[model samples]
Target chain A: MNSTLLRTSALRSALRAAAPKTSSRAGLAGTTFVRSKVTLPDLPYDYGALEPAISGKIMELHHSKHHNTYVTSFNNFSEQMAEAKHKEDIQTQIALQPLINFHGGGHINHSLFWENLAPTSKGGGEPPKGQLAKAINDNYGSLDAFKEKFNAALAGIQGSGWAWLVQDTQTGGIQIKTYANQDPVVGQFRPILGIDAWEHAYYLQYENRKAEYFKAIWDVINWQAAEKRFK
Target chain B: MSAPTYTLPPLPYAYDALEPHISAQIMELHHNKHHQTYITNLNSALRSQAEAVHASDITTQVSLQQAIKFNAGGHINHSLFWQNLAPASSVDAKSSSAPELIKQIKATWGDEESFREAFKAALLGIQGSGWGWLVKVETGKEQRLAIVTTKDQDPIVGKGETPIFGVDMWEHAYYLQYLNGKASYVENIWNVINWKTAEERFKGTRADAFRIFKASI
Candidate 1:
């Protein structure tokens, strides 16, 4: 084959090869988090794009309304906190319970929640490549097994919480964990994959049936984006 | 940036999505009630503690220390757990060759799997109400993964190393189905492992590990 043709073939092959791994990544490398004044992020895609799996109504209420409330409250809480600090009023500060965690956690988790999704047509089905694949295979014997285990683990959550696939930094292997609420994996491990088990994440579309929502969200998972998340 | 604030996070999936494995009934209670409780408690503690810290009031700070640790740790760990499990994708494909991060782990413990296995054992072995962590100690940018355990709600950040991964061993974390079967819970949690995020963390913290691994290599 001519060099140009050969190059074209190679390029096609590379693209085909890479198509799979680019789905799940949030592109945090390019996602510059400068910690500017904290504000609610506008949803990147229309709230309804995840339809059937997630309703537009839910997205609207969850994002424009719920998440925004958190952002606003977090800012207000912080401002008051600063004042509390100035006055050295320990009792008043103690009274501010719940506001900081609820709003603060709302802001953080929703930011991640928005980035975790993409439209179904955008390479959301099935994971493409890497140790994530091999690890899944090794641990569960197959991708299907991995998903089953994950879904099962997620289903097993009790009360308001989350299910996660986190890397054990000391051993550098992936491990699954669940947190009661707005807990970040930072202190114990580096977060890699997190599934929100909150009712609000699914109540509208799935009603009180979380499993249906879990099954449906797979349609728009953005696995290729996840691949890029690898270092 | 502005100290810190707390809030409830919306779910990434709809309520019924995880059915069979998880009931929508459970999810409703879990998010609105359980998770919300933590956020509320954390905020209260932070507010009170901020006041004490500003006042330089030893008695108040000391008394609230427990509250701060538990609530703050809960906030920190849960948020990280959310980001860790994105939808499954090949973009997080396993490296065919030794990823630089794996090389460092190998150098430290003879092989990557060995290090991983040891870390797993440490996490799975936790006796009760606490956490297992892998952290990188900073020695002028050189870092190494060290397994540490925290009791109740103490966070690992204050322990002098950059956190890499944290495993929760609380029964509330897995008791619905695993029910006292912590081993099964730990083992099962590995299936949807997110190597991609781990890779980002590895590369981002390379300087910390390089300083330590170079000598051993």
Candidate 2:
């Protein structure tokens, strides 16, 4: 985690350096900026490791095709945004907002989602311990009750979205929240566990039987990750 | 380079026209919110495209293609969808109202029931946000009926093809009323389908079928 944070900070510094200085037109014209591209993150486990919960084909497509599309599209739009900014083209910049939001949120959401799962051999589905377990029990009575509530929230989503178990930054209370489309959980809420309700996440394996996918996913959830986030 | 802006076409009937099969709440949101957003976005993107064209920025113009396609498709699909529905109690909703289209459907699928089943299957088979369409395809004086689907707000754009009618399979279309029972939504949508519109589209030219856009603009 520390190494990941370091790498992210380094990438940010590189991006800052690459950004054209609007005041220095001659400098910008002479120098070529080597922008740092946002690449797809490697999954912690093999695609098939989740097994009966999520199929290998589904994982492969979800990660490689769907998630990668978001990453690539986001990168493309980011480049366009930079150019638009350099040119001071406000209309073009405004038009790029939705694309940036959708693709950027997709990338962020999927990155968190991948970390929120694991294989059974690695303590996946093992109930949360310590503070996270206590928080769940304190807020929602029991783990079973919390799961039921979470699943209900998932089922209630009207369109492609995500159901997240989030901790309120100020109050420290755990709550269930749903976001439409690729909108990410941000601001006052920190997402501890996020289950994607997007059709692409489970349709290849479960098809229209999304309830089964929702139920089955709990079996492979990496509670340890949730616990870490809670702390 | 100024592009014409689009306005949301009013529903042909009241929001409650479909009743128990589809709720007024669903229709209200689907039309007023969802469909309106598409038109608004489409107009905005077109305006941006106009600016891009004026500035001779090929990259910006190219980047706006998806926004154009998605929003324009949404507008086209919803416009057609509204016209292809009537009150469940109206005479236009009956299968008997569309003799020519029914004859073609029977010829293609052997019976109306078989054709409906195939359409339902196409609707249910859509994995994500998409639409299922019953289209008229013409090939060298030979016209045929085919059921097809397009992913994520894509409208039917094939040459020599006209959408007779389409079903919005996006969860927002039925999730408020059907929840996860999409099969039930698929089964019940027939109650409000306007066969008269289907018949007209089947017998008319593609330009005639798409006359709704002209009226709106």
Model 1 lDDT per residue over B1-217, tens place: 1235678777655554444333455445556765566678877877888887888888998998776667766766554443333333334424322276567777788986787688778876443356776666667756776778775556656534665556666545554544434577666554434455555555665344223223321
For model 2 the TM-score comes to 0.55
Model 2 pairs whose backbones collide: none
Q: What is the lDDT of residue B24 in candidate 1?
A: 57
DockQ of 2: 0.07
Candidate 1 residue A109 Cα shift, in angstroms, is 1.3
Q: Write the per-residue lDDT of candidate 2 for residues B43-76, one digit (tens) a residue.
A: 9999999999999999999999988998899999
Worst 10 residues of 2 chain B by lDDT: B172-181
RMSD of each: 25.6, 16.6
Global lDDT scores for all candidate models = 0.60, 0.85
Worst 10 residues of 2 chain A by lDDT: A14-23
Q: Residues A88-143, candidate 1: write the lDDT tens digits.
A: 89877887755566556656666656656666754556575786777667767887
CAPRI classification of candidate 2: incorrect
What TM-score does model 1 achieve against the real structure? 0.43
